[model samples]
Target chain A: MNLRDFRNFTIRDYQDLFAKGELVPRELLTIFLERIREVDSLLHAFLFVNEDRAFARAQKLEEEGRDRSVCPPLWGIPIAIKDNICTLGIPTTCASRILEGYIPPYNATVIERLEAAGAIILGKTNMDEFAMGSSTENSAYGPTRNPFDLERVPGGSSGGSAAALASLEAPLALGSDTGGSVRQPAAFCGIVGLRPTYGRVSRYGLVSFASSLDQIGPMARTVEDTITLFEIISGRDERDSTCAPYPPFSRAEIPQEEEVRKMIIGLPREYFSEGVDSRIVGTIEEVLKGLEKEGLTIREVSLPHTSYALEAYYIVAPSEASSNLARYDGVLYGLREGGEGTLQDMYFRTRTSGFGAEVKRRILLGTYSLSSGYYDAYYLKGMKVRTLVRQDFERAFQECHLLITPVSPVFPFFLGERTKNPYEMYLADVFTIPSAMAGIPALSLNCGYVDNLPVGLQIIAGPFQEGVLFGLALFLEQMLSLPLPLPEIGQQRRS
Target chain B: MPGHVSLEEVRKIAQLAKLSFSEEELTRFFQDISDIIAHFEKLNELDLEDVSPTSHISWSQPPMNPDEPVDWQGSDLVLKHAPCAAGRYFIVPKVVEKEEKLS
Candidate 1:
């Protein structure tokens, strides 16, 4: 096939080609590597490309041969992994200088599952330092640019993975979302991303950011491709105490038209508040109107606690982050500083030098919140407000099967716009943080484009109700029929 | 209970967190963190006296595993990443110092 066809191919299409004996795993790997080489310079999507290991795995898969009945679901598929998730012998830096040159000795449970399912790892993608920033600009290495507009950010923490999929460097990728890490970037890059239920996926290998809110999710170009990867990565693992005792998710069938027609969709009024850009509101309304004509019931719902979610998230996330990052002292792995001085001096020097500006800010904020005198007023209050956020979703779901909202307040913003203002960066996550606080599953898909930039529509469901999300996303995908077009960078290279 | 944060408080927090910063950095961080905390003060507006805190959101009981220790085969691999390691043990700066006896 030609370059144009490769850019549009999904996991299912590749699987069909392999089954028909028309393509081999190694050949596909070469095509992906070539595309990455051509465009990665401009996008900066990947931090490391596992060229040798990927070729070896592809060769082994070729030698074993593709036996459709016996082969794993993701057989011969190449996928990108965010830098925060551990992969044995691969550098998992989380885009921070503290983890510079650090290699993991063990694979994260998700990595093990993906490898077992016959997926090949392309390499680790860049992310915000310790996953703290909403934009990828916080990364010490560099920020990943949006594929659609070279000057705009690719939405972040998972920005690298989203940009890679949108540019067709990889068909599938894994990203960890705490707050809007997965969905926001997916919305900005114009691809599909899902933040599974808090315990739906194991967290043994993901670098701890905010333990209560962190979850591994899947990102791809289409809804079905996302489901395939999500089913493989999600399940129970005894290693993580927080992981639920649920069975592995199975591939869900597309719901029939009648089943979808009977469902009621809720629009939380707080998600469409005045802060949201009028263009995004208009785009989502048009999509909702289309769904209404398709026989689905649309109703207004109130989630009163929505305004408090951002404030609570900022406090809670940093507090947990401060505690989780305490392991980075000079005694163990990672960077060491002030070795000639006393132990206390070493710790002070190492942490101060190792972390970036934003990371340091978060660590300091967390330390202040969890300090002895202020614990009750800051940290405790944040958790209590978390309960109110959870209650809001619990009450909303009682009336509707699922909630639909805009993924981000604005479109993919230009780089350096919000970098200097920490509060503005935090505000970008207002729409997605409520579901994260509630520990529910949420999905982001492109609804339409405003001024040539994509608008993301978020679908949220009750705990373990990912099937509902997939069903609605599939229906909306069919209705929108917006194919993954070649991003501007790719188009420029072609010309 | 006070909303205003002093630079002295920022220094104390830095000490507690085991991190040291330059004077310029301390001043900037003091300003930024005070702004963030001032914004977080909005949480106090909600009267959550009757609401209990949610530490975890999962509905399932945390599965209990047997308290068994298993041998790890990757000890060498783990030590390979340590910044200061001698064989299997990690090296650290001296934590104690000699002092003259009290007279």
Candidate 2:
């Protein structure tokens, strides 16, 4: 098949072809690998491509398909995994120098499930070092540029996974959302990203950022494809103590006309604050209008603690990071920098040389917040504020079924615009953080475009309400009916 | 921000965190950390006296699994990535030299 045909096909489309024996898995894998080789150089989306292994798996699955009565859920589908998620023998670098050559000893639960579903593991995608930054610019390997306009960034630290989907390097990708990592990048790339309620997905193999807020989510070109992958990868794993020990996620049937008419979408006033770009506000209003016309109720709600979310997140996330990253002391696995002194010297030099600037900056910030004298004043206080943030959602949800807002304050910014200003970069996550702080599920989908950059509308549901999110997202998607197309890669270079 | 962390305090933090930076780098970090701290200070404006901290967001804890050791099928894979390993144990620099005195 040609590039356009391959890009346009969704997971279901490929599955139908596979079931009919119309398309060969090995040939499709070859096409995808060839396309990735052609365009990945410009996109910088992947950190490691498991070409030989992926091809082998595709061939094996193809051979087994002849004997099977029913096709597996993700049969023949190639999926990209964020580098932070372990993949047994595959290199799982968090786009950091410290874990440059670290190969995971066991597959993440999600990887095992995908393999069981007969999915081909395409490669590991790039991300911000240690998932510490908003833009993929913090990636030690290099930034994953926006395929639409090369000068701009693909919002991150899940930027590479989103870019991989948008660039057609993979039909589906997995990424961890600590704060707005998954949603924001999905927004910027004009695709669907679902951050399941924290604990909905097993975190056994996903590296921790802020353990409480981190969730492994799926990024895909369409809502159905995203939900399909979400169902396969989500469940309780004994290895992750915090993973909810609930039954396998069973999505409720799509909402009927009466159900759709009864749905109430809360518009949090704090999300449309002055910091939001006028164009984005206009796009949101247009969507609200569309929702209203569809007979859904739209009401204004207040999330009083919205302004303090970024502050609370910076403190909470970094504080958790400092403790989590202490394991990379250069002894067990990953890079080890040796010197001429004691064991202390080796540790000091190893971390110093191994970490990038952004990683170090967060480490210092976290260490300071959790230090002996300041723990109460900083880390504890941040947690209290986090409670207030969650309470805001609880109160707001009392009056509405789901909250609707812009995924980011503005459309994706040009690369380097906010790099020098850490606080400004943090603000890019303002709209999405409150829901994440509440441990609720939220999904981002393309609503419209601003100056050729995609603007995403985020629909949030209370904890474990991913079913509602999917139905509503599909509803909004059909209402908007915006033309989704692959990026004309390698054309623009304004940067 | 009500607090100002001096370079000595930052150095102590680095030591606690098992990290080190040059003098110039420490100075830069001092300022950056201060700026971040200042930004985080906005959280102090809220009255959280009645609010309890949420360490984890799970609604209810799941029952614990039985404690049983699983065979280490991953020993070789884990050892494969180690920078320095002898047998199954990771090797590291000497903690105490023969002639050097403890600090």
Candidate 3:
């Protein structure tokens, strides 16, 4: 099967292929790895690939001869990791020069869990340095092009994870969603992407961006694949104080037919503002109509504070990032350039020279926002607004089962096109940031296409309401006929 | 009615963040920080006399468990990644007197 057809196969299907001994895990993994080798120079989806180690894991699993019911959920499944998540003995650079060649001695808590559940690490995927930008172009390794259109960017900082799944480089991929990093790229790539509720998944090992906003989730080609990976990773961990206890995720079945029409979907007016692409709004209307035909009721709701979320996010994220990134002082876990003079100069030189332009830009912004005189004026005020944003979601969900919106105002833009202006890049995150500010979960699925590129419909649910999100996304998948066609690679080849 | 964030304050923020800047870059940073601060001055005009500052999106309930000192153990296997050392002591840059450095 081609990469397109292969990604459509569920993790269960691939495992069954392995169970019947029809296709060996090593052979299946190599098929995708070879595709990555042949195509990734143009796509730049992966930062590294550990073929030998991945093969070894496959060999061990094969000898064990355990089916998924007895084995782990991820047994023999190849998965892509966002570059920021630390993997033991693998470079966890966060796509920044400051952390060049750095290797972790232990996996991040989520990484440890995924491996224990039977995933084969395909290597780190590209991302915005420090998960700061909306476009993968901010990565020091270079930008990841959208699989659909070569010159266009894969949405960031989880861009590569999304691109890897889109390209069929892996059946499943792991990415962190701070704002829209997971959902936006999943939208642009026409894949099933979920951002689990905050604390639903542990974050002890994921590199800090905005501690309050950050979460790791899965990207795959279908709703079921995303659900399978989520069930495996969601749980509390002692190492992360933020992780909360979850209901047994194994019982998280797709909402049944009897419960189907009971869903209350809300359309927030603030989400479909003047700037949103009309065509996307129209596509969402059609989805709502189709769902209504199937017995789901739709209501128009208001989240007045939604407008301020993007601005509030900029202040709060940078404020936390400014503090969290302090450890990368060319001291621990980064590129350290040895220099003469006091220890201060060594830190000064290493950070100044090592970090790229976008990372430096963010660190500066974050530092100022959290600085002495400005803390309350900027950072504290942002936090107040953040509360309002969260309250907005809480109020809307009071009237509905889920909130639907465009994942992004516009579709993916050409790489280097948006990089020259950072504010423009920030605006792309407007629709996605509200969920992050509120610590709610949102998923992006291909609803329809405009001008041949895919447009994603975002389904948002209140905290710990992933069940609602999965139900609606799966229902839409069966009801909506506009399956996003594969990226037209030939007509849109990258430079 | 307002405190100006001077060019020097902006530069100090960069220094605290471990970012060394050229003279020209420092001047530009000063300008950018000033412009951003000016734009953010809208908050002070809000007449927020009684609003409490919120730090997280979620309400801060008292944590389910109280913080207590624990006798945690560590192995050199993990500690080897620490940046500074003289035996077990983390030898940080001496920014203050030894008395002040006691954490």
Best lDDT among the predictions, by candidate number: 1
Each candidate structure's TM-score, on Cα atoms with residue i matched to residue i, is 0.97, 0.97, 0.92
Q: Write the per-residue lDDT of candidate 2 for residues B1-103, one digit (tens) a residue.
A: 2467788888988888877788998998888777777777677678889999876687547759989998878888788789999887888899988998878
Q: What level of docking quality does candidate 3 show?
A: acceptable
Model 1 chain A lDDT-worst window of ten: A486-495
Candidate rank order under DockQ = 1, 2, 3
Q: Which residue pairs in candidate 3 have backbone atoms (N, alpha carbon, C) closer than 3 angstroms, thus clashing?
A: none
- Candidate 1: residue A19 Cα off by (Å): 1.4
In candidate 3, what are the lDDT values of residues A306-342, reduced to their tens digit?
7677767878887888788777765554666665555
- The DockQ-derived docking category for candidate 2 is medium
lDDT by residue (A116-169, candidate 2, tens digit) is: 888999999999998888889999999999877888899999999999888888
Q: What is the C-alpha lDDT of each candidate?
A: 0.90, 0.87, 0.79
List candidate 3 stretches off by more than 4 Å.
A1-7, A481-485, A488-490, B1-6, B27-50, B59-103
Q: Per-prediction count of colliding residue pairs?
A: 0, 0, 0
Report the lDDT tens digits of candidate 1 across residue range A146-218.
8888888999989999999888888899998999999999999889999999898999999999999999999
What would the per-residue lDDT of candidate 1 be over residues B1-103, giving only the tens digit for each residue? 5468899999999999988888998999999988888998788789989999997788677788888998879889888888888977988887775573545
The worst-scoring run of ten residues by lDDT in candidate 3 chain B lies at B57-66
Q: What is the DockQ of the complex in model 3? A: 0.35
